[model samples]
Target chain A: MIKKLRIMIGTNKKNILALTFIFSSLLVLASTQFPPWDVPVEANDLENPITVDKKNLDAGKAFFDLSCKACHGATGLGDGAVPSGDFTTKAFTGQTDGAIFWKIQQGRGLMPSFKAVQETSLWQAITYIRTLAAPQEIVAMKNATIVIEFDESNSKKLITAKVYETLENGEQAPAKEVKVNFFIKRYFADMLIGGSNNYTDDNGSVSISFPEGVPGKEGKLQVMAKLDDSGFNPAGLTEEVAWGVEKAAYWNDDRQLWKNNDFVPLWLLISFFGVIGGILIAILYVLLQVVKIRKLGVGR
Target chain B: MSAETTDIQKTGRSLKEITSDLLNPIRSKKSSVSLWTMLLVFIIIIGVYAYIYQTMTGLGVTAMRDYTSWGMYIGHFVFLVAVSLVGSLVTAILKLLEIKWAAPITRIAEIIAVAAVALAAITIVLDMGRPDRVLNIFLHGRIQSPIVWDVTVVNMYLLISVILLYLPMIPDIAIMRDTLTDRPKWQRKMYKVLALNWRGTDEQWRLLKRSIRIMLIVIMPVAFAIHTVTSWLFAVNSRAGWDSTIFGPYFVAGAFMVGAAAVIAAMYIFWATKPAYKKYITSKHFDMMGRLLVLTGLVYLYFNVNEYLVPGFKMQKLDGQHLMDLFVGHEAPLFWATQIGGLILPVFLLCFKKFRKPLPIFIISIFVIFFAWTKRLLIVIPTLLTPTFPIQNVPESWHHYIPTYYEIAITSMTVALVLLIITWFTKYFPIIPIWEMAKENGHDNPHEKVVLDDIEKD
Candidate 1:
């Protein structure tokens, strides 16, 4: 009977563990679940009026970055702080331009509606989102190179990029009118240095005076020049330069009141312990006197 | 020798008579006292039940939410801490200044101090959502935090107050051990054990006096530190109502005011109820305590003007909002009532010789003590309600705070606990120090000199 009771208790323990596991899993799942959202049928059939071009995509990308990127993520992977629609997914991309537009215009639950946004800007945002669905082919220049140089002849620091393409006869020729973009690499993302008007001249180079007050490690910055036009293979050159403002040392080991117990300010430690210790000794002395009084009573 | 003999004749009662008079309340079993004890016990039981329910459920049982996080419990804590300062004021400060009249009232103040500080410590735990994690405070205490400082000084204050209470009571306890032969065997044993086997030796008296003297001096700063640290718990935060440079002295001043009032209230209750106590706690004591109250109240009034008027003159945006709420807004009634009725009128009325009488001053003290509590709540709640940023996205109930019934019940339990402790101390032992009264009546050694044969006959 005792063995039977032991077996029943063992089974009960297992049952309780299993129940706890199931309950915890349900709680986790319930917390992560998003409420369902629906769009009107008429809204789903509307077409996007804006064409997908470099200029329009650029405008849309700027707007998306300012607003939607915090929720929808940089590459639209729905992996932002707030869970949002992944534009790369068929679940999102298969929806008509009108459905996506309607969702953006009329938000649900945690999602905020963009009713105050301009109509043209909304279409431009849609045009840029379509490019996130899949990768596209790029035609490459067989032998091409880009060089970044710091030109200080004009008193101000200028970052100049020269683009070159090798001809059939193996001669390097200036690749004129080739759109180039210059950027300074930062921790999270590259910051554009030269504006969108950057294009190679007949000398195969474009120049932009370096901006001031950009913080860098030890005053050195990583400058990159990339080919921006669509018909070329992905290419860019990165060079470490000394154009950025020097970053001061951010952290120090000085003692502070806010520091942990090990590193409390020296003066505070002394005063705190000194006052408390003095009082404690006084208290101990009084307690000892009481003990003496008790002993004196015993002797008497 | 002539002066001492004349002083003894002034009381017109022998040392033996004084001892028995003081010890009579302990021997008498009054039905009214039993009923009062029962009522306090009933309230304590209900409070304990509510506390258990709160711990079982959570702090959610209280009306406190995210915005008004430190609600009624914290207000009670501040009030208790403030009231506990009475011990140092009556026993240490007055004794050090050689004020002879305050000697009879010291034990009453010490009892209030011990009870208030003990409840103040418990009230902090009651405010915690997780009372079980209270040990984490000592395990990982940061010295720089105002909270750790508060806990340290409060514990120190409690220890010192208890010692002050106990050291003076040893001779009296010895008196009970020897003279109260008809008490229960357990009661006799308790008195004997707690008496430290005193035979009233000169050396024992010497040590007792020395220890009490040391405690009297040490308790003053520890008492000051306790309330000052409690004030820092608010002043360290950059809240509108609490941000002040003079908060330390301001709190100390306010503490003395309320502490004096609390002592006066206790004095009146004892004087009115126990006929034997009237000779010791006389209208003279009431008149003296009333004057002390008025003095503290005026000092507090000075700090009050500095606290409010300077800020009111500037009327900085946040400070203005906070001041406006107190001056002419929703909280104006409580604010004005606490200031005018509690502080101003009590101070104003107590200044007069007629109003300084026992019955009148006691009534005023009741108002003062009650309004002092409301003043603490006003200091805590309104500032919390007026946040630096607008309070948004919470439930409508979060906007205003009215303590739930459970909170009120739990708070009332602390009050009952204080009263119950005082009642037990008075019932089981003499509240007034017999030896001190005899000494005051010019007996150098009251315990040895006074004949106890008649005490047994009585």
Candidate 2:
């Protein structure tokens, strides 16, 4: 039997094994990232003024009682159980009634639509937003520091922060110093200033400030925090916060979260085809060798 | 080709005298066109002109659409690639094993491989959306795409096939250059270019053998890549039926099956035309090719079982409908016919000793090649038509891709073009490698006596 055996092979078992290993590794690498099911968030300026109808206002109150009040608190102050945004802050005034109206209609990040909240109730909710205090009036006399905060509504890490002088053109140039406070459901750590720590007001309020000589100081300043799409528009959603620096500007380094938008969802299709194409070629090469061996036969 | 040599020997007049007498007739153009030859050539020309019209209008003239970007053209290319796979069996496979019977059929198989692969590459280009930017495939190629891999592998296969064809032709070309003292001056010049300064020295002979051995070694992998890449072009896509793990082997087996069929078909054409080749090609050659076909068919059948039956076993929501479309559904007629007529029937027919006869094998091969081409079309188009997205479109035809007249014409052109290339080469060079043939016959010709005596010892 040994004397009669004839072998004419293109690839040995080892070579085929090596090729298979390589393709397997490529498949793993190609499919490492799972396709995203996350929604997207975009800049929306949808504003529509409303008539001062008491019925709509009452409906808005009912709607607000159902959704917004739990976080905003009954007084529209940052006194909710979670110490959510103080609707009655200096930040509140800069946003026009239209902006507020838009916010109520579209619902900001972490918030669901009021579209089903009743057509009249949506306008009513805007009427209530008007009563909230502007950030300028949100001064805490005890610590005498204006506070600005931005973070994820439903579990997201803080991103980046910067303070800047407010300009007439709405550009906020970076300031000399910047700081932010922390409050996780009343577990307040008074304040975390620029590389330092200080306590907030007795009622638990931390203050933020922009140093003097910051370029655009005159008109208005802002502190903004970028929020990723979380707990809301699962498909297309993001959260942002902006406040005047003279009044304590802050920004969340949430660039990563908003950038979640940049990741395309259609990439899964590409990888699926990629793996298929790879295996076919690998097997073809292997089988061709087999065919060669088979054709040559055992006995010449 | 030995039968022609015997015709003169019955009289024992002298082959040398006959050769001298035939020389004038060969050079002079006596205009011998049989009716059948005329008809075949006429059809070939029609296919050529139709293809020309398609090339001018661009792939848009085809029935393909954005969703079904690969329709009949890919279908044809896949079939061609499959058909080319038979070359490995006759050439690399047989030569490696030192099989004596591999000699007569090897050149025929190799020619088919070269022609089919050459045409396959052209068909793929014709299917491209931007054929002019084909260079972009190299410049900005993402190895991620199967298309890029295909471009690399097919080009490599093309190179290997040419080398395989050329190496065996060196001595033959030398003979064409030096032998037959009364041959035309232009014929001698053609032989000189083909010979490339072959003085047939020991060193030259060693170099030729070494190069051929290297190519034979290299060609198996290249051949595999050509068809696998062709299969991957579909396997990689996320379509219903096309998304299969077994597709690579499935395609390889299919390629071998069809390629063997192509070889059989070509053998018959030679049998009917040359009479000389029929003597050497022999019924035994057909029997062997048929056995090889049976093997390929069985392997393809096994793959089909895995490709279809295993998926059917799962009956996953998607796989169920996809298989049904071919099994007992809308494409039932075409799908089953292609699978049965193209694959299963050929396997069954090739199993018997009687059915493996040259004429029967030839008939089976024709059926196999034609059905295999349609099978590829069935594999690609149906899966594409039913994408993940609901089918809503600008035109009804877009929803149901049907190749236009131009597509069919262009496709036919590629076929005709392949034949045209083969015809041109055969008009000059021997279709059966003369040197290899002469060696098998012990170089009885007086001109080769010294060369054969020197080389035959090895």
Candidate 3:
């Protein structure tokens, strides 16, 4: 059986050992340093007293902003402006609600104890903390489909788009009065192709016409309609059509430090090399003198 | 009066008496290892074991984390480099300025410098999480990085210190080669090899003096560079408490203060242990060093005030929290103690002539060294903890750094290792320059006199 296991794992002993070493290292890294902190048996066994409903969530959020936002950040992502204990870890979230309440009541190190806060309020805060799982942007967008359609009946080159809300039965109905943007896509970013006063009408549709000679490949035009709303993922739909003259790619010679182009200022280049090069050369010269002196000794 | 004539008219110890007196430490039977040495060795063993444990377990064994990345190790490194600069200050700078009284103290400074710089190098490596990747620094070093500058200056400082330690010891080594012919075969061979076959020819002496002069001139800037670049490792960062123009001079001033204190501490230890060299290291030397310490202390005090006061007064938004922590918050106790006890109190003590005596000076130096070490800890840790924005997702323990037992052990090991280096060096070497003392006392080497005259004429 041992021989069969060896054959299944690796033929060579060294290879098997290397694989074991790598796998064990990964296991160690995956494990958190936070061992289970001691909690009172009462606290450990107790369930959160407050019901987790919308009212409790709002209450929890109010308290969280009041007490914890400075350190725990708005979303409880441990990115507070003030230095404090990170509550975003599995080690933190894995604890029972009572244990968290106890910890908050009796703070350690940089974390302040919230003993004055009522137990029900603390429970509400814990509920808010729990709600901070990754935001539901993608899921919300998937449930709302946006469609763009083009009509050029009068050769006016008009484009129309619509937003539809998906029902529980997987059926779609028109969504009304939602703002939409029509834009032509560019290399660095999308260029808005329509006016700012654009939105879906009561019928859930937007109509706009193409502007002059926006160039693309082989006189092809690419335009998109996007649903722009705060706290929601932007749902976009794009359409391609042969409409305008083709334009060759052009270069922008703007100088920026992050772009890695060799457009550094002359004085900066001179000063950097002059100072660092001078110091290095001076140090090197001194070292070389030591070598010369060592050579002057009785024996080489 | 010419130097040679004045030496003849001075407190005349004959050449033979000087030679025998200076060489007694080296030629005598090796002193049995003291209990202190044994204790140091034991601590070093434990430290090595702890290091092995740390390497196996990773840096998690230490209390350091993303926020407070550096801990006691970097603090200890700063202390080592600070003390090591005394070698340049005493030996090279004083010798170049032609200070006659500094001769007996020069070797002590050089040995301390050698040991401390060596330890500084080792301690910095110990600070690295993956020390094996240290070679990658040289292989893929960015010239613009402050770390590269630190490495460059530190290595240069080490090389210069070692050479400076060796150059003046050549004549003394020759004395050992000739005098200790009756010693063990291995020791005799070792002395012979290290002595560089000095026949005491006039030409050789001239060349030696010229080399020593060149090294002295070159080493001053290198010494200053080593510590300045080290300070820049923090100062170059935009972090509060570190983002000041005064750090370079501030660090240099503080280094000289602690360096002088270290030399005083060593002087007391050596003077108390070995009575044979009582004539060589006298109370007069202690008085001079005490006065020098007071000057450095005052300068360091001025810089310390400038370092803190300007920021505290302006209360710039970035530095406000850090200054508050240092001034009145959790860090205030250590901060105030370091300033008052380490910098201000030493100056106060050294100001009185009565305290400039050897024993009082030694005790004061102990306080200085201790406080200086803690001061470095304050410099490295509090600023790191008070960074403007907090690093996310780390355990709260990352907010405040308290070095673990492993860190304490490794730091203690480096300290003990430096002492061990000094111990072995004192055991094997003369610790005082026999020929130089003899020459200074007007036991004229006729050959050297001719060479000196010729060089002066040319």
Which candidate should be chosen as best, given DockQ against the real structure? 1
lDDT of 2 by residue, B1-458 (tens): 24434453454423333222222223335446646446556555555544443444455456676678778888888888887777776799889899887786787788878888888888877777567888878786654566776877776677678768877776766655565335667777877666666665444555566667766777887788778878888887766788888888889888888888887888888777665566567899889889988898899899988888887999877767777877887788988888889888888988899998878889999999899888888888888877777764233456667676556656766776666666656655666665555555544343443442333322
Give TM per candidate. Answer: 0.68, 0.57, 0.66
Write model 2 residue lDDT over A1-300, tens digit each, in one string: 222111112221223243333432333233232343222233234444566543444445556666777667866785553334567666665555555555555543223345445545666676655544531232211111222445444444232333343444766443322223222111232222233332333333334343332222342323322111111111111222322232224433333322222332345335545544564554455435433433332332
The C-alpha interface RMSD of every prediction is: 8.2, 21.7, 9.0
Q: Per-residue lDDT of B69-129 in model 3, one digit per residue for the tens?
A: 8899999999999999999999988888899888888989999998999999889889887
Listed in order, the DockQ scores are 0.21, 0.02, 0.06
Tell me the tens digit of each residue's lDDT in model 1 across A7-103. 4445432332433334323432443456566778889888888876666766786688778787788777876645567889878878888988998
lDDT of 1 by residue, B184-205 (tens): 8999999989988787777887
Q: Which stretches of candidate 1 lie above 4 Å from their native place? A: A1-251, B1-11, B29-33, B445-458
List runs of model 2 lying over 4 Å from the truth.
Answer: A1-300, B1-59, B180-185, B444-458
TM-score per model for chain B alone? 0.95, 0.87, 0.94
RMSD of candidates 1 onward, in order: 12.0, 20.0, 11.0
- What is the DockQ ranking, best to worst? 1, 3, 2
Candidate 3: regions farther than 4 A off = A1-300, B1-11, B390-396, B448-458
Q: What is the lDDT, from 0 to 100, of the residue B272 in candidate 1?
A: 90
